[model samples]
Target: MTANPRGPNAVDRHVGSRIRLRRQLLNLSQEKLGEELGVTFQQVQKYERGTNRVGAGRLWNLARVLDVPVSFFYDGVNEGAGQPGFSEGDQTPIVDDFIQSADGVALAQAFARIKDSKVRRRILELVRTLAAEEAEATATEAAS
Candidate 1:
């Protein structure tokens, strides 16, 4: 079956998100990725936004450029329940969404480069403390 002309299918959106995720993980800009795929950066944007469906051959090319198997795009996609990349039992989507952002990707990359294990632990503790404080503040605001 074909998807609607105006909007992408769920599978297409899932694949696009996966593409964006992998591209960010590799620190590749949309233009660079588009160059590798022989497409314009605008086209890449469309693909990443799920405004366009990737064909089989194009997906194969993308897999090669991204250094991931084609199946990577479909890893979390659910075909049965009419939802793509969302499973009833899965709980980490919010985290995934955050990590998919440029700032989040940069943070992860910088954190990964830290050589000192102790420093990494300290940083983790600091972030946890900050998160706890923010949660408490939010709760207080909600109650007041």
Candidate 2:
């Protein structure tokens, strides 16, 4: 079946998000990925934004270039109710959105380079604390 007329469907968006996330994690620019795929960077942007649907062969090529299994693109998809999309309660999209951002990618890469498990745990705790404090401040402001 074809996607919705309005735009790419949920599955397409999810797959595109995965592609973008993997590309960023590997520190590859859209231009670089496009070169590897023999496509222009604008084409890569369309794929990343789900403005264009990826063909099966293209998906296979992307998997190979990204050094991941083909199934990676469908990793967090929900197959419930005979529909292919993310569930309302699924956190994958939220996490993917964060990890797709510039700051998120930088933070993730820096964190990954830390070899000490205890240090990693401590960093996680610190981030959690900071987030909680920020949330509290936001709530206080909202109450004002």
Candidate that would win on TM-score: 2
Instruction: Estimate the TM-score for candidate 2.
Output: 0.82
**What are the models' TM-scores?**
0.79, 0.82
Clashing pairs in 1: none
Question: In angstroms, how far off is 25's CA in candidate 2?
Answer: 1.4
Lowest lDDT block of 10, candidate 2:
81-90
- Quickly count the clashes in candidate 1: 0
Residue 65 lDDT, candidate 2, scale 0-100: 100
Q: What is the lDDT of residue 100 in candidate 1?
A: 73
Sequence-dependent TM-score of model 1: 0.79
Q: Model 1, range 1-144, lDDT digits (tens) per residue?
A: 753445676667778889999999988999999999999999999999888989999999999999999999888766452345444355437766777789988898899999999999999999999999999999999999
Give the runs in model 2 whose Cα sits over 4 Å from its true position: 1-7, 81-93
